[model samples]
Target: MASVNEESVRKIIQYVGGKNNIKAGTHCVTRLRLVLDDESKVDKENLDKVDLVKGFFSANGQFQVVIGQGTVDKVYDVFIRLTGLGEATKQEVKDVAAEKGNWLQRGIKVLADIFIPILPAIVTAGLLMGINNILANPGIFFKNQSIVQVYPQWDGFANIIFVIANAAFTFLPVLIGWSAVRRFGGSPLLGIVLGLILVHPDLQNAYGLAQARSEGTVPVWNLFGLEVEKVGYQGQVLPVLFASYVLAKIDVFLRRHVPDNFQLLVVGPVALLVTGFLAFLFIGPVTMILANWITEGLVGLFDIAPIIGGAVYGFLYSILVITGMHHLFLAVDLQLIGSTNSTFLWPILALCNIAQGTAAFAIFFVARQAKMKGLALTSSISAWLGVTEPAIFGVNLRYRYPFFASIISAGIGGAFISVLGVKATSIGIGGLPGILSIIPQYWGAFAIGMAIVLVLPFLLTWVFSKFSKKKTEAELQ
Candidate 1:
């Protein structure tokens, strides 16, 4: 590991308007997140020029500087030392930054904070699902049968792989519960227990309840004369999030009021009982309904006009990325894949990512400065690998026109893919490698759509760059 760079940390503080300007600071996997007292004081141009700073953006009221993976911690250490503020946890920093947002923004930030920690697990599971899809695809290897079907002897092996791939999503509520309670400064074990209760074996599996509800055969439990649905919260995001928040509050309150001698035994049991009842009686049902509606609404709109929906989504997706709210769609994407076995949104997202990468590549050729060209090349590669923060903030957005050019190109490519009905069977990455997640039947369409995304943005940005250069020269003459 590299040691903390004190000089770089000093420049970061100065460029961000000094330690006094930052109310709170913390680092995540790849960025330094700071709640700034005055946004106007930030010297973005100078900040970007700082050594080791990849890019910067303000989202959800936090001024974020991208430090890349692994290096963020070292920089964060120096930052804490320089600011004289004690080291803060990621959740604490999120809380401070969240304080500046309106109700909706704060709500989204809370979700992001809760989910971000567990994204690596979800993403890894998604990639494994993609691999499993290939293994199960009949057209890929065997003639008229999947690999598992063709080789009965290998069935057990395939099933084990499937279980490993499915574990994260199948018990997602537990992960969310654990993370959410910790974020709220409560006992994680109790949160995990609450999560287990939500997804107990005796309860009806959430996925199956959809079918059961349609058949009018869904089971119900009588809890103190109240009829409660016996549904497991498997793969659920919102319900567990709400339940954990309620649990944390109840736990904290009980500890404060309970006698010290009896606190250990009384607080845990009472908090769990009350929180569980509330979760089942109100919070779980309400949030699940909201999650279902949001999922159905997006699916419904896409069904209404696939091409238009794809175009609109691709055009606006980068904006969501800029605001750090893109994680909001992870649950929806997972749900769509879990229910329908495919998602149109993932294909469109792939094109949008490729389009941004292509725009950055064009900037590489057009840039007058060698340093700009190097940044463009590296950021473009990063974007192609499904990480677009570098390309968007470091290169394309910095150039202004390249950003718009990429958006337009992405919209057109997204519409093309939508018209072709390209659907991904899984959701792992979102660029060149993302094609691995697409259904085998739509692989050809995905390739063609990606080609258009790659070329069109490069051509459009290159042309715009030439015109801008000529105009500048003419103005000087």
Candidate 2:
């Protein structure tokens, strides 16, 4: 509701050590996360004193300033206008900021950048799948028979729902290919075409290919005397990602060397043909093998010690969210569900989100300032609806102790879920609504786990706030 003007934007820029000091700037749901060339140039004391600034913190090499929800967009627009950094994408900002990190951090940043744009599609599909599961679940409404079985006429409708739910995941490579190529500064259309080639109708559907392979019924094509298995890329993340990267590099190289007159004709066809072969022959298989190995390793680890695994994952999950690297889990979780029909990770992740929300709610009750209380209440609701950034940046991270309390509480809940062997059949909206994603048989355990996540974090943070020195709204600045 707070409107930012040109003067306000100027003040913000001045307090952040002027436009020259800002390496890159971007906005998330409620914060303007900036990468500064020099952190010390940021007048934290004065910047915090700026009007409409809710809070400030540094995490994952980015200096983040909370500007509340809708207000951030207006402020970001003015900030960009004043700084003359016109219409920069979040991924572009991340790429600029990523210069400070080592190889691993940069690599993770790249993966997150590529995947974040496609998350809404995946999350939506997951939620749809959850709803379909509910409809089809015999244990729920249909007494020993699914909804379709009870009403044979509804089979076509169920089939339509299934297609709607799986469309994104079934063609996930196309999305990833587009995003990855764009990230690599290559042609997105070419990347999409390459993705289409990977999942061509002639190829065996990826989900069914495993069974077909076991039955020795998979078709193979002879390409230059090399026998190439015709397998589609479905619900695959890493293979497409790797293939896109190769495509991007090749495209860029071709663009640089190829004559301008022949660029359009030569660049696309050559790049696609070469990348297509490389993708199917080398990149796809190699990355898929690597992805499977990683998935299996994590599954094995969880199987070996589910409690410890869940606790550790639950604790670190939020930390990953803070670093903006949690999008990497989308692929992993999808792969897990594809192979196992369920994943132990999503249930724990749901608990972690609820824990953060509960901690924020505790802050709402205890905060002396009306503004902080309002922020806490609003952020808590957002967290409960499966978005945690507001709660994390606005309340938990600001007070510090509330965040640790959440991690502890979430870890406990995670351990409990692991002991019960509760798993999610789909990766849907998190928090309270996330229970829909859990396998019907584990709903009871999930509810209990959710209760622990809610109650323990609230109590811990509330008790801790009483003893810890309270920072007044003024002192918080």
Top TM-score prediction, candidate number? 2
Question: lDDT values of the candidates?
Answer: 0.82, 0.83
Q: What's the lDDT for candidate 2? A: 0.83
Q: In candidate 2, what are the lDDT values of residues 207-280, reduced to their tens digit?
A: 88779999999998897898988877777777888889989999999999999999989999999989888888
RMSD of 1: 3.4
Query: Which residue pairs of candidate 1 clash?
Result: none
Cα deviation in Å at residue 39, candidate 1? 3.3
Candidate 1 error regions (>4 Å): 1-13, 24-34, 44-55, 64-92, 214-216, 223-226, 338-341, 470-477
Model 2: residues >4 Å from true position, as ranges?
1-14, 18-20, 26-29, 43-46, 73-89, 223-226, 469-477
TM-score, structure 2 vs. true: 0.90
Put down candidate 1 lDDT per residue, 1-477, tens digits, no spaces. 858668888999999999899998888787898999999999987787787787777777778888877988889888888899888776677788778878878877767767777878877877877777777778778677888788778777777777898888788778888889977878998888988888899988887987889998878989689888887877777788889999999888888899999998899999999998888889889988887887788888887898899899889988888876777787678667655657889888888889999999998888766556676888899899888877998778876778999999888888888878889866757788898778877888889989998899999998887778874233212
| TM-score against truth, every candidate | 0.87, 0.90
Worst 10 residues of 2 by lDDT: 468-477
